[model samples]
Target: MTADLGHGVPEPATTAATGGRPEGHLGAAGPAPQVVLNLARPWGEADPLDLAGAALGAGLDGVTLADSPRLFPDCLLETGRILANTGARLAGPCVLSLGLRHPATVAGALGTLAAHHPGRLLAVVGRGESSVRNEGLAVPSLRTHRESLDRLRELLDDRAPELRLLGAASGPRTIRATAARLGGVLVDVGADPAVLGKAVRLVRAERPEAEIWVFLRAVLTRTAAEADAAGRPVLGSCASRLVRAPDWYDLPAELLPRVEAVAAAHDYRRHGTPAARGGAGRSPETERLVRDRFLLTGDERRIAGQLAAVRGLGVDGVVLAGALTGVVERLNKLATAVRAGLAIDPAVRTGPAADPAAGPAVRHRPDRRGRNLSAESEE
Candidate 1:
């Protein structure tokens, strides 16, 4: 079926002709020099302004505004203002897809955000049963999904801004559509490099210029014991998510049972036998699995190594998965390590900002490339 992803949305003309390495190909240039981090306020407890400030303090690249729009409506707009005030890059709705069915609503929301943040805004779209259920909406079918993307593209063109639309989609069809129509696709989960490679190829094939990015979870430990112990709860789930490769070594062995359980729960039993446990993000076992698979735990080297693996997998950058309480600190440590590895400048603070509520007064901070800083650094 021909889905009507937004019209006038420019499609990448040719992947081969595009001036970059293929997805999963981290060349001498190294992985894309962008990192995204999460800064969420706990349900009913997070202040968007506070979260934004912390991200700036830690010199984070991006601050993804989480749930509780009631607490911070037009969160992107507010975040853009904060980023402008501080010079921190921004990205989000990391879990928001409520307006996917209504292109007008999407346009209006994005229009407001662009008006406030202009080039600072990134329109991320996705679908999740949990998110849709929470919003009292029905989960959309794949066909509808394609249509939604089309509508979003149309809306984006109507908005008339230079900002990019970042799609948080990974399934094959969604990835293909994203490549064909949008500026970039945010691969937030999954661990199969081959799968990601294929997704990249699809995008590159249709639109070589389309940016391919991967979001990864990492946790480092000083020793195997700490890594194992800290990773115990989520080990199985993490292992299950990993599409095994000879070159990668961070997958844990202790969490096999949880992995099996998670695999079974997701109908991904082709990977291995089902464990005695059951389900995806439920139960203590499942919760642990989720933690292990989605978090990077260990020392700096270990963490950096895991990220390196991600780079080898053809990912452009990693959008950090972190908890609210320690996210800023984690981001700081991660940014430092990754920057050192990539040989990028280490000073990435959202500079000279005392507060988020203050009106934006942005300054131009160019990268070593002499180009304006890219929003890709914003998670």
Candidate 2:
């Protein structure tokens, strides 16, 4: 599917070449970076399960649902529906927060899901977001977060031995603690390569083998106005969650007030709407900071460059938050960008090409000399 990302930007040619496999391996790149969707607006106009199936169809690795019970749909129910509706082998959805819910309740829900779907169910818990705040509950302390994760992990083993427990970490203590305990750590710190690089180092320092996934606000366009409009809501909300502790970023003085303003003005009650979360982004400067250091918003090559930079830092995957609106097209556009270890992509086409599924026109593997020789030329 050739999706026009407005501005006449077509879907990445890599999407066609990989035959829509999210794990499209570019040789010697370790493995393709896992591209997953984290629904910033889970209960929006789109059906969550249909969105999950569409994501799987468009070469995405996984889907994670928002578990803000008071604010939206029941993530456990939605996750199970996706498992049942979508092809089990190709996908599963993670519940984004068990921080607010009791570990026993979470265990029971997941156990029931496992009994029905078995290996297709997945869970990732975090110190809750809207799920906590919207209900007037205090954000769990780091120690409380650690305890909740441990109990959930233990309970899941009895009911669903195959279930993997991944925890989310946005700060130093949580990053260290989650790494020591969970199967993987969803690093939701920031999208900046530098921050992610530091986060990657921190995760590995605690547990070398931990799976590290960074959560990013991703946009597949280069228009400054469009990117700002699309990015502000999500990024502002993220700032509110992550920018509280000044030391978390060691943020500069100039950027400090801007980020702090965004954090302060973001309202979860009006979550995921441009109007509600338009904080410091009223100016180009704040938006640029977000684009450069906190979010992904640019043309395919620029986006690819950022992805490559992050991948170079040894990140395992990326969760595209606030992506449910145009999930499939955006992911397809990002397929080539998600590649690792290589600076230039062989699959990137300069002009129109035939559909790769047609069997003749396709991307060729890079040779040992690192040359991308086409099949037509190699023979």
Winning candidate number (lDDT) = 2
Question: Candidate 1 regions off by >4 Å?
Answer: 1-32, 67-74, 77-81, 98-101, 135-137, 191-195, 222-294, 312-316, 324-326, 341-379
**Which digits, one per residue and each the tens of the lDDT, describe model 1 over residues 138-245?**
667656765676677776676743445667765555565555556567765444444445555554454444555665555444554544344333234344444332
Poorest 10 consecutive residues of model 2 by lDDT?
370-379
Q: What is the lDDT of residue 240 in candidate 2?
A: 61
What lDDT is reached at residue 372 by model 1?
Answer: 15
TM-score of each: 0.62, 0.76
- For model 2, how does the per-residue alpha-carbon lDDT over 39-107 read when each residue is reduced to its tens digit? 545355566766665555555655777667655577777776666655523233344565667888888
Clashes of 1: 31
Please give the CA lDDT of all the candidate structures: 0.47, 0.58
Off by over 4 Å in 2: 1-30, 42-44, 88-95, 278-284, 323-331, 339-379
- Quickly count the clashes in candidate 2: 0
